[model samples]
Target chain A: MGSLEYRCLKATGVYNVLSEALVEIRDVNFAYGHRPILKGMNLTFPKNKVIAIMGGSGCGKTTLLRLIGGSIKPTSGYVKIGGQIIHELDRAGLYAMRRKMGMLFQFGALFTDMSVYDNVAFQMREHTNLPEEIIHDLVMMKLHAVGLRGTHDLLPAELSGGMARRVALARTVALDPMLILYDEPFAGLDPISLTVVGNLIKRLNDALGATSIVVTHDVQESLKIVDYLYFVADGVIITEGTPDEIKASNKPFVQQFINGEMDGPVPFHYPGGDYQQDLKLKSIERVKNNKRKVTERYFGLDRRQKKK
Target chain B: MMAALTKNFVGLGRRVMNSLWRIGIGARFLSLILLNSGISFSRFHLTVKELFFSGVMSLIIILVAGMFVGMVLGLQGYETLKRYGSESALGSLVALSLVRELGPVLAALLFASRAGSAMTAEIGLMKATEQISAMEMMAINPIARVVAPRFWAGVFAVPLLAAMFSVMGVFGGYLVGVVLIGVDEGSFWSQMQSNVDFQHDVLNGVFKSCVFGVVVTAIALFEGYDAPPTAEGVSGATTRTVVESSLAILILDFILTALMI
Candidate 1:
C-alpha cells in the first residue's frame, strides 16, 4: 500500500497500484506533412516497469517512441519525462536528458562498420573519459548479460539475426540508462530467440531498475513479460490495463488484436466500391464484347496456351 | 484548351516553387554542417578515413583519365602546331589546357561520379536502415559525427585529387610528346616553364578545384541527409547526387572562369 496507489484507488475507484510515471505524454498530436500519425494521445509510463505499447504496424507506435526520445517535437501538447518537458529542452539539455535514455531500434540498427565490441562500447567511449581497460570490462559485462560474451569480435553482418538483436540489446543497456525504449524487439526472431530476448528484456529492466517502453504487436510474448499493456489503434490508446485486465478485456479492438482476428475493426480488404457491383460491371462488359479469347487474354488465362 | 494551358502554367509554377524550396533547405543544411564541423576537426581520424574512401580510392580513375586526356591533347596540339610550324609550342599548349581548364573540370566531374554518389548512397542507406535515428537516440549528433567528417574529407580531398590529376596529365603529355613523338626535350621543358604562370594559371586552377569540391560534396551530403528513408529513396538520391553535382561543378566552373579571366 503505497501512498500513490491509495491516491490512484481513491481517484479512479480502481485498485491500480502504478508506480510514479517516468514518462508523461499529454494530449500529444503529431503528423508528417499532411499525414497525421498520432492524434491527441495521452499516456503514462511508470518508473521501472516493462510497459508494452501493442499496436498493428504503422499505428504510430514508433512515432510515440521518437516523441519520447525528443527526436521530433509533437504538433501540439507536451511530452514530459522526469518532470521536464522534452521538446522545450535546449540542445545541451536535450542531449543531457537523452544520456539517461536508451533506445533499441527495430532491426538492431547496429553500426555496420564496427565490430560488436566497438558497437556496445560506442556510447561509453563517446560520453565518458574512462580508460579503454574499464570500457572493455564494461562492454564484456553487458555482452555477458545478454548471453553473448563470445561474439564481441564479430561484425554485425557476421552474426545471425538473433545474435545481432542480442548484441543490440547489450549495446542499448551499456550505459545502464534510466529509461529503455524497444521498437519491435521481437520482430523477425525465431520462437526460441524471441523467448530468450523477452526474458533478457525483463531481466535487464529489473537489473538496471529502468523503465522500458516496448512497442510491439507480439501479443502472447508481451503478455508473458509486461507489467502493463497499452493497446493503440487509429493514433489513440484504445484500451489499457495490466496483463490480466488486458486478457479479460471485452473491448472489440483488444479482442481482435489479442485473438489475431482478421475482418474486425481492421478490415481484411482494402476500402473500395461494392465488390458485387464491380463484378456485375465486368460481366456486362464481357458480354457486350462477346469475346472469350480476348477475355482470357486480358485476364492472363491464356498465358499457359501462349507458352505452349 | 484554356484549362489545359492553365494547368501547364500551374504545374510549371509548382516545380519552380519546389526547386526554390529545396535550394533553401540545402542552404540551411550547409550551415548546419559548418556549425557542427568542430567534431570533424577534433576527431581527425574520421575525416582521414573518409579521405581514403573519397580521395585515395579515386586515384586510379583520376590518374588513368588524366593520362588519356593529356595524351590526346599532345597528339592534337602537335598536329595543329605543326601546321603553323610552331610545333615546339606543343608543351605550352598541353600545359595551359590542363592547368587552366581541363584538369579541374574533368577531375571534378570524375570525382562527382565516383565519390559524391558513394557518399549519398552510404548516408541514404544509413538513414533507410535507421542508423542516423539510432545515433540521435544515443545523444550523438549525426551531422557532427558522420556528415561533417565526410564533408570535410571531400573538401580536402577534391583539390588534392585535382592536383594529382594535373600532374599525371603533364607526365602523360611528356611521355607522348618528348618521348614518343621525338619532340626536343629541352624545348618542351623550357617552353612549358616559360608559358605556364604559377600565379595566374596554377593558382586559378586550384581555386576552381576548391570551389568544385565544395559544390560537389555539399550537394551529395544534402541530398543524402534529405533523402526519404527507403530503398527507392536512397537510389534516387544517389542518382540525383551525381547529376546535381555534375551540373553544379560545370556551372560553377563557367562562372569561375568568367570571373578569373
Candidate 2:
C-alpha cells in the first residue's frame, strides 16, 4: 500500500531509542573532599515508573539522592531534572525546582519537636498561602493515607519506628511531587511494615503519576515492586534490567548479591597479604601493642581506649 | 631525638592548620547567622520557644550565683573598707565590682555551660538524625529555620540575664552589707550612687555582655553546624561549645574592659 514510504524508512538504517526520561543524570562524579564516592555515574529515571537502586551500604546510593535534590553539586558532570540542570541553578532557582521533588531520608528524620499534624502540614503552609481550615483537612487526609490520622497530635518521639516512617512518607508526598527519592525506607521495619511500605511506595507513585527512585539494600522487597533494578558496587552500576532478569541473571555480582552469597566480586575480609603471614605478623604486633599499652595507660585508661 | 622533634613539629603544624580552618568556618557561620537574623523576627513562635528553653531555663542558676557572689563581696568589702576607716565605701566597692566585672563575665560563663552547650547538642543531634537534610529536601533552608531563632534568642537573652544578675547581686550585697553587718543604709546608698556612673559602668557592662552573647551563641551554633553526624560527634560539639564559648567570654571581657572602662 505505502511501498515508497517503507523503502525510504529502510534506507535510513535507523531505529527508535528510549522515550524521553523524566530525570537524567549524565556522567555525574561526586566526592567528599578528595575521596571519591561516585565516579562517572550515569542514570535515567523514566516518568511514572518505580526504579530501585540496589547496592551494598556506603556504595553512594544516598549520595545519588543528594545529587538529584541539588543538596550537593556533582564533582564532574550534571544532573538534569525536568529539563533543568540542578547544580547550575541559583539558590532560589534550585529551591523552586526542588518544590517538584520529594525525598524521604533514612531513619525517618521527622522534625523531632513537631507534632504529627504539624509535620505533615509543614510543606503546604510553607509553600502555599492556604487557610488553616484547608491545611487541617489536607494534613488529616495525608495522615489518613498512611493510617496515622489517629496520631495527629503525637510528637515524633511518641510514635513507634514504623509509625514514624509512615508519617515521614506522608509528609514527603504532601506536595504530590513529580519525583520521590527514598533512602533505605525499609531498613529497620518489621515484615508487615516492610511490605506495607513497599506497596505504599508503588501505589503512591502510580496514583500520583510520579517517578520514584528507591535507594535500598533490600533486594527481595524491592524486587517485588520495582519496575526496574540497578545493582551498583564500588561506585558503578554493574548491571540493570527488569526484576525478572536480575533475579535470573548469572553475573557474579548479581548472583552473589541477589542470593545473599557470602563471597563474590565483593570480598568478605579486608584486603591484605596472605592470611598465614598476616597472622604471624599480627601475633608479634599483639605483643608489642600490649607492652605499649601498659606504658601508655594512666589511671586504668588506655590511650587507645581514650582515643575512641 | 631529631625524629621526635620533627614529629612534634608536624603535630604542632597540623594543630595550627586545623585551628585556622576552624576560624575560617566560624567566620562563615557568623555571617550566615547575621544574614538569617531577619528571619528570626518573622519566625516569632520558634524564637519564643527557644527563648523559653535557653533564656528562662538559665535564670535560676544565674540568680543563685549572683546572690551568693554578692553576699561574699559585701562581707569581704565591709571588712577591708572598715580597716581604711571608710566603711561606707563598701557599697561602692560591691556595686562597682558587680557591675563592671562579675555580672557580665560570670553570667556569660554560666550561659556558655548551660544554654550554649544545649544549643550545640540539640542542633548536632538534628544533623545526626538527618532532620537538617530532610528540611533541605523540602526546599527549606536549615540556616534560617533551625539556627536563626536559637541565635537570636541567645543574643537577646544573655544581656537581659546579665542585667538581672547585676540587680540581684546588688540586692544580695545590700542584705549582707547593711541589714546584717550594721553599716549605715544611707551611706551605702549614697556611696554607690556617687561612685557607679551609668554610662561608664552599667552601660559598658551591658555592651560587653551583648558582645559576649553574640560570640558565645555563634560558637555554639558554629560547632553544631560543623560537627560530624554521630553521637560521639554531637557530644564533642557540646563540649567544644562550652569550652570555646567560656574562653571567648573571658578574653572578650578583658578586651572590653581595657577599651571601655
Candidate 3:
C-alpha cells in the first residue's frame, strides 16, 4: 500500500488491514418522484481495488455514484463511506467528506472557459493554501501522467474528445482522492484512446492505492481492468463475480450480456401488444389504402393530379 | 360533467402548487447564494470578470439607447409644450422623464434581454454539460464560485448602467433642444435645474434601478440553476429568463413607483 493509503486508512480507523471495504451501501433505495431508480442495493467497494458496475442505460449506475458522492440522498437506508453515513452529513460535513472523493463525468465536463492547466489546478487551488509555484508543478505532473502535458494550454473545446477525457481524468486525481468514481469513462472513444484510458484508470488506482468505482457499459475494457464486476439491471444487482466466473457462468442474463445477444431476459423490444397482431392490422390498413389509391388513379381523382 | 369540473379544479390546484413550490425553491436558492457570497467578495477577481461581461460589455447599447430616447423626448416634449407656450420647459420635461421613469425601466428591459439572457444561457449550459456537477464533486460549492459572482455582478452592473443611461439621455436632450431646435440654452438649463430635484427625482430613480437589478439578476440566476440538464432545457430557461425578468421589472416598477409617489 502507498503511504497516502496508509495514512488515510489510519485516519479513518474504521477498517482493519483485512477486508477493508471503503464504501458500503445497505438496502439503499432512490427514486425521482414516483419513478423508482435504485431499489434495495447492497454493495461493498474494497479499498485499493478497482470495481466496475456494469449495466445498460438508465439502470441507476450513475445514480449509484451520486449516492456514494453524497450528491443525492437515498430514499431509504444509507450509504456509508469510511464509516460515516453520506446522506446524514450536514453541508459542511458533506463538503469535507467530498474532498476525499473524485468523480469523472461521462463527457469530461471540464470548464470550457478554463485551459487544461487551470482545470487540473482547480481543485488544488480551491481546497488548499498552496502557492502558485507548487500548484504549477503539481498540475504539470498530473498532465504528464495523463500523457497530455503538451495540451495543458489548450481549452477543452480545442482538445479532441479523448484528450479532453484524459485531462478530466488528470483533474479527478489531482487531489489524490481516496475514492474515485468514473461515469462511463470509456464511452465515445476510439480503440486506442479506450485502451489508454482503461490502462490509466488501473495504473492510477494502483499508484494512488485508492478505491475506484467505474460505472460503465464497455464490458470488454471493464473486464480487462476491473478486480470484480457487478451487473445491475432494473435498479438491482442481478449478479456479480470475478471476470472469469462471469465469463463461465450459465446464467442467461450473464451469457446474453457478455455475448451481446439480440434477445434474452432483457428483451430486445419495448413492452408492446402482440407483434403479429399489430403487423397484421397494419397490413390490412395498407391494403385498404392501396385499394383507395387505385380507385383514385382509375378515376383520375388523385389529390396530386387535382392540384396540378 | 362532475368529473370534468373536478379534473379542471385539480389541474388548477396542481398548477398553483407547482408555482408555489418553485417560488420556495427560488427563495432557498437566494439564501444559498447569500450564504456563499463571501467568496465572490473575498476573491473579488471572479466578480470583476463577471462585471466586465454583464456590465462593461453593455455600455454601448445603454448609451446609444439612452441618447435616442432622450432625443425623441426632446422633440415630443417641445412640440407639446409649444402648444401651451411652454416650449422653454422642454429640458425639464426631458430630464424628469429620463431620470424618473424612462432611464431605469428602459435600461432594465434592455439588460434583461442582453446580459440577463446571456447569464441564464451560460449557467444552464454549464449545468447541461455537467460542469456544475463536476464542481460539486470537487467539493466546491458552485453557488459560491459560479452563481454568486454573476449574481453580485448583475446587481452592481444594472444601477451603474442605468445611471450612465440617464446621463447620456441628458446630453442627448441638450443637443436636440439647445442646438437643433434653437431653444434658448439658458432657459433650458435653468428650468432643468429648478425642476429636477436631487432627492425626489435622481435618488428615487437610482433606488428603482437597484431594485430592478436585484429582480433581474435573481430571476435569471434562478431560471438557469433550476433548468433541466438538456439542450432544449437550457434554451427554454434562457427564454424564460428574459420573459420573466422583463415582466418582473415592469411589475416591480409599478409597485415601487406607486409607493414612491
C-alpha DockQ for predicted model 2: 0.67
lDDT winner among the candidates? 3
Candidate 2: CAPRI quality band? medium
Question: What lDDT is reached at residue A153 by model 1?
Answer: 93
Cα displacement (angstroms), candidate 2, residue A257, comes to: 1.7
Any runs in candidate 2 off by more than 4 Å, and if so which?
A1-19, A33-35, A281-308
Among all windows of 10 consecutive residues in model 1 chain A, the one with the lowest summed lDDT is A1-10
Q: Please give the CA lDDT of all the candidate structures.
A: 0.91, 0.89, 0.92
Which candidate wins on TM-score?
A: 1
* Model 3 CA lDDT for position B217: 94
In model 1, the Cα lDDT at residue A217 comes to: 96
Which 10 successive residues of model 2 chain A have the least lDDT summed?
A: A1-10
CAPRI category for model 3: high
Question: What would the per-residue lDDT of candidate 3 be over residues B31-113, giving only the tens digit for each residue?
Answer: 99999999999999999999999999999999999999999888888889999999899889999999999999999999999
Off by over 4 Å in 1: A1-7, A10-18, A33-36, A277-283, A289-308
Q: Model 1: clashing residue pairs?
A: none
Write the residue-wise lDDT of candidate 1 on A9-42 in tens digits: 7378564344577998989999999999999998
